[model samples]
Target: MTSALRVLLLCHSFNSLTQRLYVELRALGHTLSVELDIAERVTEDAIELFQPQLVIAPFLKRRIPESVWSRLPCLVVHPGPPGDRGPSALDWAVLDERADWGVTVLQANAEFDAGPIWDHDLVAMRPASKGSLYRREVAEAAVQAVLRAVARLAEGGAIAPVAAAATAQTWRPSMPQSARCISWQRDDTARVLAKLRSADGQPGVADNLFGHACHLSDGHAASAALLVTLPPGAPGELLARRDGALLRRTVDGAVWIGQARAASACGEGKPFKLPAALAFAAEAQRLPELPASLERPDDEWGELRYRESGPPGARLGCLSFDFHNGAMSTGQCEQLLAALREVKRRDTQVLMLLGGDDFFSNGIHLNCIEAAAYRTGDSAADESWRNINAMDDVALELIMTTDRLTVAVLRGNAGAGGAFLALAADEVWAHRGVVLNAHYKNMGNLYGSEYWTYLLPRRLGSDDARALMQRRLPLGATEAKRIGLIDRCVDAETGAKAADFESGAIANGLALALSHNLAQRIAAKHQARAADEACRPLAAYRQDELSRMHRNFYGFDPSYHVARYHFVHKLPQAWTPRHLAVHRERGTAA
Candidate 1:
């Protein structure tokens, strides 16, 4: 193992990649501090204060200062192969249909992404959005490449020069609106999907919706029933609206646009992403509505789903909720509560809550809450109350389910209220690569709800629970298991491949495993519930948690509201928090 060094993390935002690197590096015994890529003076001050031996830039929007790079060794993680260099690397790769991609850990130089390559790890590309690919494939490859680069630096090893790009491997310019505009009169469903998928998260596909210009996101191919219901006036015509999405006809088929941001909502005519129907309420209400339930084969684009397996009395029930960005809005929480209730009515011996592929849940919908302030003349506080109450209802339902064994199979990362919501289940199963942030203090010291005060102490004792909450650090699957937060951590090898974690094959294996020995599991679950209820009623637990959460929502202290606003609006951070910027704290490691 390399000796520990004082490392500085400089990034545009404390994004997923930055968080993962922070946790992993800390685990390896390195002292770390973070500084956002704001002004050049701020960067200089951080460097001088922290006095870092090495700096790592996981994500950056602007160029690094030449002064700092010339003084100390800096490593830059570019989301492309060694021969590739550009601002729109991932975008062009997806649009151009590249089969293989990689993350390159190179040194900082005069030209961007043209530094000597310390290490690089290639990954096979899948048909996914640039955002999804970055979160999953790019993230995985980045960890490997970054670690290799760091190790090389520690050992003072020679770095390899980046090979010259062939004529075919020219620079990819920033994707323009012309390339993103969908030609409803000419493009087929596949072509349209590719364009939208390329721009899924950032600068969404610029297109016309309801005769108004808006950026389209969360695009999915329309189901057969949806395609049939359209009036067929012309291509690009809004066909129908269901759940929170609107269906638009394409040349061959149609696409279900789950969410859209109008060109007139907020900020320089760039609106934050809102549900398609909500953004165009008047127009969407006129379109035909489809059922949100997954029971219908024709249904598409709903956030929540339900399924049942196994035989007779020994059955397994699976309830999956795939909210965009894993956010549970007030309506989404209510729909999920109803689904959970219906699943309870079944005779299933075991129940599994399958969250989305990207995220299990990140707590209440901050974007939706923020939208309420502008859309409806209501305060964000009011919307927050409703959303939290709905989330509690869903958790209370699962907590009170004594008849069947409940399992929260986390296919993706769970944070804040979402992590506690998962704890409401009897058993928590997570994939190897999953990250869990159980604490809520990171959100401006907001005390969380979802019966965490009751759920956490039961799983982990009072002392460990308190420490876990105060840490405000991301927990990897193994550490979470060790701390008793998760019951089991399944390695990615149990499935067909490691990537099957994204496909939910781990959840399938979990269901099958429970089915093999379900009778005992259900009986034990019932007995444990009876014991816990006898000691203290579940109602008391809910009351206590809600009492505290009530303060977080409506208390005179407006820190939560202030924090929520800044987060939803994507405000730039003034400085790194003391928790992350260890250099600012006393008792610095030397």
Candidate 2:
């Protein structure tokens, strides 16, 4: 048994959980201090006054300053699980209709909510009122988890942090009011319901038809009310009224009013009725076209919205490639290359957006590759060499030659050529649930792309990259990051957590690691040249092997085998030197 502990509680609002913890700590004969409205910065007064050996921040909106944290042991009670660190965690989970949720206690770091977790307690929810669930169930779970964490800390026992993989499949931020705006033209009833639920009980879900203003309310489970002005020549618009509900017709769909308030003559009294003449005039005023319902087109996977508060030109330029339908055609490739070259001339930083939602790409179109090979009527070795070389050129142009910083944001499944495209970027940011595969080897083709020969080795080491190619491995986002294939992993579906990618964290981290005092010395000598040359032989070897593989695999339908291999093998193998050395030598230093 351990002695009682000193605890400090930081919170914006005093809730039942905070009260419970206060009582529990006191009952245990522990010292407890409470602070309210703490900002990100820590004041010396606070440190001196509390002088806590262990600091516990529960329901605190502000980030703890390094000054305070560096001095003593501090733990944050996050409302969500390891990867679920962010504001609005509960709201998002409910809106997404997730089956499970949890709370985590982590060592606080400069980076918000990303610290290695100490312990967590999972919370299971049934279909109940969102407000009640949050206030009751979530609060209880949080307090209990915190108490356990404190006990563990006192005993000096290690608490294993849950791996990101242990969590659910999707993530998203708390729904913003903008997300709730209903577009009559683009959205269906189901989508509308989702949006409403996302912002359910929030201030903006329902709005006045005339001014388009939403009602302001507290919490997310409260009833919503709205006001509307009817159009002229709208018959019996008040034909139906039940309770406070009002029914009206629009140019398109029939509008159902769940609840409404009619403005008084002076707009100052209760049970007020809008003057008939004024209501007519307000409706007649020329209003801009009402937006269509919010329906996403079939082609759109998803979109990422970003706000930058940096200097002018600080925002990176975006270079987008749509592999949505399929791989780029020769013509498309040529056009893309030309555009990239032009962007380079302008010195613009570029971020490539591949297919939205679930795919950066599926890789080279099988039909295109097969046609080219058949037309040549060449030996397996000859056709493979040509195809690999072509792919290599495309990859190299994007990865090596571009002057501006390049990043690839992948939200979906990427395979073969798609994987290479991501690797080519200066940094790769992927959602946590993304699937990445190197399907080339199984397709009877070696991994033929360019800088991948160099980049893969730099990231995963030559041995690992070789194994991956040889075995045609497919990886989850976490595995990809672990092997250095991708720079960072995030939950793509929810966009909730601040994954390492949001602020160019990956690029910055890599730059720190790679940028060395010896870099200047190495650049001055022929060491860089030597390393490049040493790798050349390996590239040539791989190219040749890849070509032969493609020839052998062609006409057999690579997809079936690739899929079978991934499902059956569980893990991909590494490529052999015997295969890779052949192609590296063919493309010389020119």
Candidate 3:
């Protein structure tokens, strides 16, 4: 057993990786507090007040001040192999096509990522983008490395230092746009993909499309039909368009560019990343539009797709909505609602909602709503209202379904209204490593309404439900299970490495389990729905919630707009929020 220790979590942002570490450490009975990397004085003040026994910087953009590190041990999590030292470690790893990579937990020294290593773990690299790999493989390795380091610290022992040698570590600078630029005229499909993949989530590859210079992202190798329809265009020329992307012919093949961000004469602005079609509307409309086929192809890329499997009566229909970064626009919500209704019309015993690999959903798309303020000459408030209502429509569809038992299988982190959306299902299951931000207060005290006023109370009484909505913190899958937030947490056993929940193992396990007692589960679902309707109608719950939401969307207050603008623009933090910077709270510091 490990003794409880006060651990101060110092990070740049409470991102996915930091949230995972926060949840895991709290589960181990560690008293944890958070302090963003704001400034040296603020960090020093936190250290003096919290007086934590140990400090862990899960993610940091700047170096820890000497005043604090000299006082306490500060462990920095670096996404690189043991001997790799740099800021752009993952970027280089993906661009270089390394077969294996790892994460290192090292003590913060005068030099960055050069401190004595407490522990490190190697993870086989996946052919994924920097953001995807960071969320999955790098994150898993970091957890293992951090846990090993913490356990060693708990038990008083001499930790082995990483051996130093000449040319042991390599330092790589931040990748510039020039380095990420793709050459459609010269580069093959694989080379172009590597460049674009390295810069997927942020700082997309700078390139030209339709006589305009813009950054490209969300790339996919063309499907069979798309490949055949490439109208013999010259290299580097835009061939066709579909949905929100434009297809460009490469030296060997073609790639669909799903998103882009065009620079304007007004200098750098908030609309840095938008759907390719939306950003270049006129140009996109000129190209031939090829609608995605309803028939699922062997190899194709799309935001939504459906697949049916299982033998005879045990037939299962799985609908996956893999939205980029799990953000759903107003149109996306309507499209997915239609897709959900279509899948329900099919002949299947059970229906499973398989969300994206990295995120189940983070609620309505903030970026799209923010973009509407400028792109479509609409008020941000108007767009937000439409988006939230569309989200409610999708949730309502899930709530009213009675034919087949609906199961929400969360394989990734979910937040805000997304958590409540999952609750719309008959049964909600999640992978072990998943973290759920169940509260909406973090986004400027926005009172969320996705039929949550009803769905949440049904699971955890009235007062507990109210308290949960107010507690603005990330909940791990295990803790969420105990609090009755989810029906089941599959493979949530504690161990070293983070759970490989991204793999289809949990979904397969669920399919097998449901197959055994299909009739009873379906019957139980029906009876529960009937009983719930008798108690109180779902429409009443939606009305009550939407009434409060109306005040939020079209009220005198503009807190949501201010907060949403700051978030969508990637504004720098003025001061860390009191909830996260717990060390400053008079009596809250551990």
Candidate 4:
């Protein structure tokens, strides 16, 4: 291994990719600091302050300052292969249905993405949304390429570019709404899905419903079972609603548009992405309602799902909750709790909680909570209170399930309240590529609830738990396993279905069925729960946490509200938080 070097990360946001790289680089013993891409001068200031040996722009929205990069070695992570030069590299790849995609670590120079490639990984593409593609393949590739580039930089060597890509370049412009536009009357299911999936996360495809304009996102190809039930209307007309998504007929079949934003939110008001049903509640109410049970077909799309396998004596119940972007609202929490309670009463010996592949859960739905302020009688505070309480209730149910071995299977990422909720399980099984943001204070000093006060202390002792909570750092799966934050971190797996909660549990369902002392272990689990409950009622821990959260919600200080607004509206960062911008730390040598 090469020696560690001082590195600075400049990104548009501390997104999943950035956080993953942060944890990875830190684990490798590199001295790292982060600076948000606020402006060119801010970039220059950070460079001067840190005086870093190298800089990595994992996810920048704009060009880096030439002044700094010309003087310092900077590597830009492009979510595309060598020779690809554009803002919408991944977007164009998805839209054009490329067989393979890649992540390139290139030297930052005069011409963007035309720099010498330090390393790159070209892999087969999966049929997924832009967001899913970014989180999974794009992220993993970038990590590998970036690690290699950094190691090469540490060891004395001459960097070079691949001859094929350096000889020529393909420059694609940023995809616009016009390019992503769907001609419902002409486009078939395949064409429609490609368009929607290409722009799933940002600058969603412009469309209309109920004679009102809206932007479509988080789409799923309608399964045969669902399509058979839906009665087709006009090509563009919505035929049914289920699980907060609206089912609309395409030229040939239908697709489930999970989330949307109202056109009215575009011009004067800030647009919020929400469940399609909620976005057009009045219009959606008039549509045909599609009912789906937990035991529905695996191919069907829904927010929650459940299945039972294995023998009667040692049955395994697998439950999945695939909330959009893993942001669980109050309704989603309640539904999940209901499912958990139902499965708890079953004769299963193990319950696997398989969260979505893109994101396990980031916590409560900030966009939905922000939307509450626009409703006639709803307040954001009330919605927040309801969402957190519902989350707490779900955590309580998991904590109380002692008869079965509960495992939180994290295929993607988990953060905030969701991170603690995973701790509610008997064990947390994480994918090797998974990232966990195990703190809540980053969100404008939120005193999070979700039973973290009780859960965190048990795994990590009181002092360690308190320190972890205040750290506000994202933990890699390996680091978390080393620190005992997670039970197991397994190798990465192949691609899973998108938006459909259809992936199986990871790490062989944590070998729950094969344990030699399964019964005794369960008995011990019961005893441990009983002991903890007797010492301090679970309700007390909840009350204390919620009491602090109450101050964040209904209290005089509006930090939480301000943070939520900026987050939901995708506002530009005024300044990097002191926690991440560590160059601002005192007593630093010049």
Candidate 5:
């Protein structure tokens, strides 16, 4: 028989799940305290009042303070597995078309969901509604897992933490309103549906029809036909109704919507009713489409331009490394490497610039992996091994080289290789809102760029680094700065401050020359020796761990199983043989 345990339920909104939890706990004769609208400091008060042995934070949007979490034992019920920790976990998993998914019950540490795992329940989900999957499947799984976890704690048995499988995968936060907008011109029906599903249960997808706000939903999506009027004076000015299917247009000579909502309102709440017409508003104005004749030679490096204002000679050559539109390609890496070498030889300073307002890079493109996997389908292990090797080569070169002073100036979010790129830099300057993380581990491949094991420990202490690597920590700028991972936090700006290095003034020029002279002297006497000796081994050890991590997490490609555990079963899967092996190795090695 189990003794009644005191459990406090923390949530933002009291949903059906919360009500069920309350009832279940009562039936078990365990005392329960409910706290809703629990944000920041309020959480501390709730904790004090409850003084419960176990805390179950479910659907709580606000981050709990470290002080509150440290006071007592607590567990967080995450919708995804340990590796799949993040907001919008379910939405991301569904859009990715993962075969399996699960929930995790983790120790409540200062870090978000990056705590050690107690247990998890796995679930398999079909291609279904996101709301149905979460409310019906995931919620039930979460309840069962919580009960099991509580039972384990009551028994006074040691809780085992499952290390997340390794891969250089990342989690993207919910896309902003602008990024989530539907681009009718560029998107196909399938793409549009994906976007609609992604933004479902949130603000629906917005479309701009000459400056009108037209929101579309799958609610009325089953209609077979639509009629749309082209902009005034444009080609195909006549309005006509046609089948509302994705098809190739005879006049346009491209894939186009067969039917669309007409400009004129047919009726209130009707399918053909014209949403308020408005001009197209994008986060960024679209660049003019390039002409086919303007293609650069394949062998030539693309010229990249950026601004660096300060005293004369004070501005360093900025690399502005970006992998937008897709993952970093081999050719792109090769071109970037050459650019870095050229900048080094020129004795210019370098700052890697990440393009796009949101992402620095998405890491190795999945398309590339899929293509390689298909080509070498007969030898899956060899294909994956080769892929990991190639990725490591590029990542290691970036981390080890770069003769000039390298600074990763992060103005936006960075993940996977983006995070690795920042870690490789001598110093990282992040904006207030930036997010940095080792997202690759969430994917099935653990052999992320070799720098994580070494740099992570150096930036955050060994204990924290271990937690981050295994638990997959996502640090905001302030948290990152507090842990010494980010050197300084600055606001986005146009002009320079006194403390900032300037580009053209006489005083700044002299300062740059003096700084350069000092840097050269340091390199000759200390920096070079330190790099080859201390840094190299540290980096190598990290790489070694990463290789092991890949074998442990993705060696057998358990992602499908892991995903099934979350989505369909809505229950946590037990540690696999591979996971146990890795855990034992770490234990014995330690």
Candidate 6:
């Protein structure tokens, strides 16, 4: 009980929750191993090989086998309040617009999620998608609950079983199409948004677009300004299009649908969740396209937006890109590049690249690339090439800029090429809770080309940079700062208060812009960039990196493609990655 628990994580996939728990457990000095919950046999094999003191199911689709839980101490993280049971916990919460929710870590039992209570954390709900809530609030609460549960076990405390519900209301059944189905003619904006929010990531709400059967997702209400352009149309009629989303008329107002999955292509356990505009390409073109300005109404939805703040002489620019799941496709990359240029042209003394609060970026869109593979004359390989190159362009703008300081302000998690992209900034300010997977080897040994060769080595130096690249693990914010991967955290980097973190950091950032030595700092940055460029041009580093990436895209090795395909389609991994399954290593306990 005193020593670190030999913990084994059994998850459906290395999702956000699992990844957060892995990072947390590793940081807590626990010897950890991870195994995908592929099948009952595989889970048994992991248990046999790991001989773990505790098993944690952070995320899973199916229930754990009775054989294992009966013999071993195991905990399952359920995304629901105590007594609220089912696979569709979050879905039901969003559908019913529950005021609050909870995450429970309970001992595994014969019945699904009906285990003895260990610990739980509760919080009020936020207006966001199911995926966003899962990553941020629920995931954070689960961490606290799991940690508390482990401590409780360490204390040899007797945990009590879940109490019986007073009514049948606590029972959450698997939502059928009838439940999430949208009746555009009858459902108001609030009702429509709730349906879309509940089914954001998985089996989306059933609806037909362009007279074709499809499921709708990524919903946002149409901005008031956009209402002026609306024509007299039926409730279910498609009114206009913008930023790859379709504006559909509703009973009271319109809602913007960002993505969809065609029913016919739902076979073979494949997914084709494409941009709503792309999903109905032929029909979309027939509708009028709406143009949105970079600076618009606050409630409006757009992936890339720009805002300038602070006093006149020393102004700050915040360029926020809230891309869905932080997956940047070729077009998104280009859009970001153009936006960066526009923002740079302004007279702001500092620029903050504020990516979404849920995820900064996970690199190129694998789903987009996977969708590309099915189209005529298009290959996932080619999409990879274009997307990476476009990403490089955005990174280049960050690296080459010398007029003002650039800061990558991360409010959420960042991975793969996205981690490197943040490095292109003069400094990076991350939230205390941020987790960064700064390596690319996991994604089929991706060499990765976001000028990482030039950026990482310069920041961390050659030896440590190479070590980090090969480590194949996530770096917590504190550890990342210790390793010089980031500049500041909740603490001040530019002499700002860290009490409110992001807000305090932003206030301090403006102070940094107005600092007396700001000009000197900018001059030094410019000189340093010029010196680096002279020694090894960014183009040279980029060309070298892209040369290797070209092979990853077009070469004989199909590892990247295969890995990406499974990842995009949400395929269950057959085996745990060797890097994560430390128990399987020789000389370790078996």
Q: How much lDDT does each candidate structure score?
A: 0.79, 0.50, 0.80, 0.85, 0.50, 0.84
Q: Which of 3 and 5 is ahead in TM-score?
A: 3
Q: Please provide, for model 6 over 1-590, each residue's C-alpha lDDT reduced to its tens digit, 9 standing for 90 to 100.
A: 54577899998888878887888788778878988887899788788888888899999888889888987878899999777788899999999898899988877888777777777888567777898788777877888889877766555654443343213336678998899989988999999999999999898888899888888899999877777767778898898888888999999889999999884433343557888887777789999888678998778878878888899879999898888888888998999999999989999989999887677887898877887776778888998999999999999999988999999988788999899999999999886678899998898888999999899988899999999999998887878988899998663221112225667667877998899998999999999988988898888998899999999999999999988987777776777888887766642465
Assess the local accuracy of residue 548 in candidate 6 as a C-alpha lDDT between 0 and 100: 98
Write candidate 3's Cα lDDT for 245-278 as tens digits: 7888888888888778786411345456777877
Note the residue pairs that clash in candidate 3.
none
Instruction: Give all TM-scores, in the order shown.
Output: 0.92, 0.37, 0.94, 0.96, 0.43, 0.95
Off by over 4 Å in 1: 155-169, 263-270, 296-300, 493-499, 502-517, 587-589
Sort order, TM-score high to low: 4, 6, 3, 1, 5, 2
- Deviation (Å) of 453 in candidate 1: 0.5
Which order, best to worst by lDDT? 4, 6, 3, 1, 5, 2
Per-residue lDDT of 1-590 in model 2, one digit per residue for the tens? 66677676665544334644665565567776555533444233444655666777776766778887777767788777667766677766655567788888777778677666666877776443344345445655676677777887667664333332234323454557675665545554334434444443333254444453333111111111212333443421332322122333433323333322233212332221121222222342333222111122322211222212222343344444543223443433554555565555642333344343325665554423322332335433343344445555566566554334566777455777667767777678776545667546645444455445666777788898888887543466666787778888764331222233333543443343344442343243335435665757546644664554554545455653343233222222232122212222232211
TM-score of 6: 0.95
lDDT of 3: 0.80
| Cα-lDDT of candidate 2 | 0.50
Select the stronger candidate by TM-score from 2 and 5: 5
Which run of 10 residues does model 3 get worst, by summed lDDT?
493-502
lDDT of 1 at 154: 59
Which one wins by lDDT: 3 or 4? 4
RMSD of 1: 2.9
Residue 507 lDDT in candidate 6: 87
